[model samples]
Target: MPSMTVRNVPDEVHRAIRVRAAQHGRSVEAEMRHILESAVRPEGRIKLGSLLAEIGRKIRLTDEEIAIFKSVRDTTPARAACFE
Candidate 1:
């Protein structure tokens, strides 16, 4: 395990983080840990699955409708590329 010591943090910024940590029921150190984790882990940071699930919920697709849609996919030939 590694430890970091931040020095001379601006008073305003320090106060803000302390206040934010309190708002989220966290200690200042714990809040900073979470912030660092989110900064470093790009895949962990984003919630694409949750967004996709929300989109899916709005779509209201039934199994039969999905089968129908799948059956019709790629039926048309691709348009010939235009090169001028």
Candidate 2:
């Protein structure tokens, strides 16, 4: 796993983080990781797979249409573009 160094945090902010960590029964580092993860990837965000599934449901695709899609779909791994 990778690690990060955050420098020059204010004393008051650090204290708040310590208190919050204790409240959640986690170490300060774990609390910081949780906070950062939540900030970047919130719970209510729309995911691509869920959106596609919803669209399929709304359109009421039949079994034959789904079979056609599966038959024509490419299953091969995509090659990376060469920039050189």
Best by lDDT: 2
Give per-model TM-scores.
0.50, 0.56
Candidate 2: stretches off by over 4 Å: 46-75, 81-84
Over the stretch 48-74, how does candidate 2's per-residue lDDT look in tens digits?
989988999999999899899989999
Quantify all predictions' global Cα lDDT against the true fold: 0.88, 0.96
- Global lDDT for candidate 1? 0.88
Q: In candidate 2, which residue pairs clash?
A: none
Clashing pairs in 1: none
